[model samples]
Target: MADFDIELDASGLNCPLPVLKARKELNGMKTGQKLRLIATDTGADKDIAAFAKMTSNPLLDFYIDGEKRYFLIEKGAN
Candidate 1:
């Protein structure tokens, strides 16, 4: 598991919801801080990665536990 500064549970949300909330959280976080996002939407695997890249935030790590998807995102200067 990766060390994270904050955690966001976007479980049950679909599509852009997870990404949108993550973006909102990341925007308030300082650079280099990591966010642990817990989501149930299967689309989050790709969506979160794309969102991270698009925002310049690094997707540090990702893993799965049953139906749940986990993403570790580190805030970027942008």
Candidate 2:
């Protein structure tokens, strides 16, 4: 897995918030950079997956770390 250049905590958020925040954060990041996102939403897995595909972001890794869901996403080429 790639090392993260940024870390975001989206825990306790629900629905689209986590994905939305991740999108917002990625907007300021350099392309190809990795972001480590920690979220607690049960729906985040599917939402983030779909969002990554839809937005052209590469989901480098995804796994559950204890009670939280971890996502390693690489910024897309613009």
Candidate 3:
């Protein structure tokens, strides 16, 4: 896996918040940068994947540790 350039702890947030904040953060980042997003929202499983696809960002990895979910996403040129 690639090292993340930034980390966003969206743990405790729900649904769109996590994806929204991720989009906001990614907007400020350079292309090819990576984001490590830690979220507890169950909805993130689908939301994050859809958001990545919609924005052209690439989700590099994902895993669950108990209730916590981790997403590794790479910013794309789009």
If ranked by lDDT, best first, what sequence of candidates would result? 1, 3, 2
Candidates' C-alpha lDDT: 0.94, 0.92, 0.93
Put down candidate 3 lDDT per residue, 19-50, tens digits, no spaces: 99999999999999999999999999989999
**lDDT by residue for model 1 over 9-44, one digit each (tens)?**
999999989999998999899999999999999999
Preferred candidate (lDDT higher): 2 or 3: 3
lDDT of 2 by residue, 19-66 (tens): 889999999999999999999998999899999899899898999978
Question: Which rank order by TM-score, best down to worst?
Answer: 1, 3, 2
Model 1, residue 62: what's the lDDT?
Answer: 97
Worst 10 residues of 1 by lDDT: 47-56
lDDT, candidate 1, at 11: 96
Span of ten consecutive residues with least summed lDDT in model 3 = 1-10
